[model samples]
Target: MRYVIAVAETGGFTRAAERCHVVQSALSHQIARLEKDLGTRLFDRTSRSVRLTAAGEAFVPVARQAVEAADRARAEVEAATGVVRGRLAVGAISTVAAVDLADVLGRFRAGYPEVRISLRMGMSEELIEGVRQGALDVAFIGLVPGTRPKGVRVRKMAHGELVAVVAPEHPLAGTEQTDLRRLAEESFVDFPTGSAARRQRDAAFEAAGLTAEAPFEITSVESLAKLVRANLGIGMVPEAVAGELRGLHVLRVRNAPTREELLVWNSLGPSPAAAAFLSGLGIDPSERSQRSGRSERSERSA
Candidate 1:
């Protein structure tokens, strides 16, 4: 199954064999034997290309799950004997503030040299879904206040509010304070509409019965800051994130939206590597929240 999955992901047999650390001929022989046993061709090969047959498309996902389950089972047994070994898949939003991700990952690698670590940067909603679907073992996400992600175990790490950020020469620069209504009058540059990042501020404007226009849609926090620094339009970002961005004037907004930083993992249970990561962060992986849908707060030190 691992070989098949490697082949599907790599898109060819030669590369898949190299990745599997086996000769191409042996890998091909094994695949052919498996296909013959199953009475179906998993891939179609030509002189120029190799692609999965319809049957192969249907088989790869299950194959991946089986392979992962086998690996996890072995890792769990090893962990029971006081050793950790397995893959750790982590996801997070680009603008994480409560915990320093790179530093955390660096420390984790130092402590668990045998564990393979992978990190993915995405929007909050997508990261939540990744944890729920088992594609990611753990995730760090930010959500609007009073909101909670469904179907995953969560722990609140910290809470923060949004602030207005403008270029140094903008009219709002050097201003200590502003409100949502006042900021609504200015053009804005923000995340794409309908995204959770965009919705954080959008909900505030909506509650005030106002509509703010963000003509430039940006998908990344860094890009949005760059656009704002160029005086294209003003922007709203988490207060903690604003402090880290150089060359921007950060202002406190009276009615700014607030968000909560959270750590999420599979509700069923965390993988061994994930459990180790949680423990390293001083979080108890076995602890469950008593607040029903909402997770309890467990802040980490910087």
Candidate 2:
């Protein structure tokens, strides 16, 4: 049956044999054996071509469906085994996750000692697609301003405020707070244009009617932190990320928009390990908003 499908796809026994990495004679023998067992002529043979016979055409769909079903069954078994012992692929943007994801993941690992976790770091856009495509069980990404993809669920994990980070000894770092207009006057370490962070930064600057002179562009948050530590120039980063840097002082800007960190996964459902991890993080998927509201009310009362 496999040989027949291969031959049908390849359109020639010799080509199918080449694809299957066997001699053409061996392929022909196997097909003949299949025909004998089925008692039907599966293919119409000619000097120039091999075409599926009427019976072969009828069998093709059933054979394809069976193959697909078998493959899905195997995948299901593997996934079920992963409930206790399997790998979980997770994605994250470099700068955002550097802040609080370590603590969350550490707690998750402590709770699910049997499941292995692998982390892939990339930009927010790429990580979103990865989650939607099932390449990643979950991802952490900066909240895109307006656009959202279909077939992915998102939860607000944390709110991140944009702040200017500078070396502790720098002049502006000593100020209690800085306005965006004054901060824009200094040479800046900028993220590449079109990035989520850059877009938010641009919007803030636009609102303030200011422009920044950014001679240096950096991609990594760690590298940006190192740059600030050297007193090279100031850069805007999430407060959580900047707080984690030892030598940097984070200053709040008067009116910068806050960036939200989100936990994203396929809309169909989360893997068991991912659900377990979220549960350990104190996030109930179905009741996140209600829980958040209750916490807010308790805080206000307190």
Candidate 3:
């Protein structure tokens, strides 16, 4: 199963062998034997490329789950003997600032050297989905105010308001403060049109009965700052995020949109490695309930 998983993920027998620390012929022989036992071809081999057959595509996920379950059982047995060892898959957004991930991860590694860590960076929606699917053990996601992701145990990490940012030479640079309505008059550089970040900014303008245009769309805060610095368009970002960016004039906004940074894990529970990491964050995973609405609100506040 491990060899098949490596082959399916790496997409070639040669690379898969290298990853599994075996010779190509040995890996190939194992896969061939497995396919014969299963009565189906798992892979289609060509000179230039290797691809999963329909059976292989269907088999890979189940194979991964089986492998993970076995590993988890082993880790649990080891934990019973006073050693915690397993894989920790963590996901987060690029603009995360509620906690210093580097510092936290460094500490986690120091304390749990037996655990292997993998990090993935993506948008909030994507990261949330990862947590739901069990592909990610834990995630840090940023959402618009009042936004709640389902099927996960959540803990609110931090909350902040968004502010308008403009180029130093732009007209709003001289202003100390502005409202969303005033900022709506300018072209904006923002996250994708329907993204949570963009929607948060949009909600602020909408509440004030205004409309804003985003002619420049960017994925990262640094890129948005670059566009603002070039005078291409103004932007809205969390106050904490804005402070980390240089060369932009930050203007306080009246009735600014708010964002919530949250820590989310599988609703069923966390893996042992995930539980250990959560403890480092001063969070008690056992206290988190499967229901993550009002109960979550109360827990986070406490």
The candidate, 1 or 3, that scores higher on lDDT is 1
Q: For each candidate, what is the lDDT?
A: 0.87, 0.73, 0.86
Off by over 4 Å in 1: 44-50, 289-302
lDDT of predicted model 3: 0.86
TM-score for each candidate, following the candidate numbering: 0.88, 0.65, 0.90
TM-score-wise, the better of 2 and 3 is: 3
Q: Write the per-residue lDDT of candidate 3 for residues 1-302, one digit (tens) a residue.
A: 99999988898999999999999999999999999999999999999999999999999888987888788789878888988899999998877889999899999999999999999987787888788877899999887765677788888888898888999999999998998768888999998877766777887788889998999998888899999999999998888888988999999998998888899998888888989999999899777633434433321210
By descending TM-score, how would the candidates be arranged? Answer: 3, 1, 2
lDDT of 1 by residue, 1-302 (tens): 78898889999999999999999999999999999998999999998888999999999888877887888899999999998999899998888988999999999999999899999998887888888878899999877765667778888888889999999999989688999988999999988888778888888899999999999998788998999999999999888899988999999998788777889998888999999999998999988732424553322111
Clashing pairs in 2: none
User: Model 3 clash pairs?
Assistant: none
Candidate 2 weakest lDDT stretch, 10 residues: 293-302
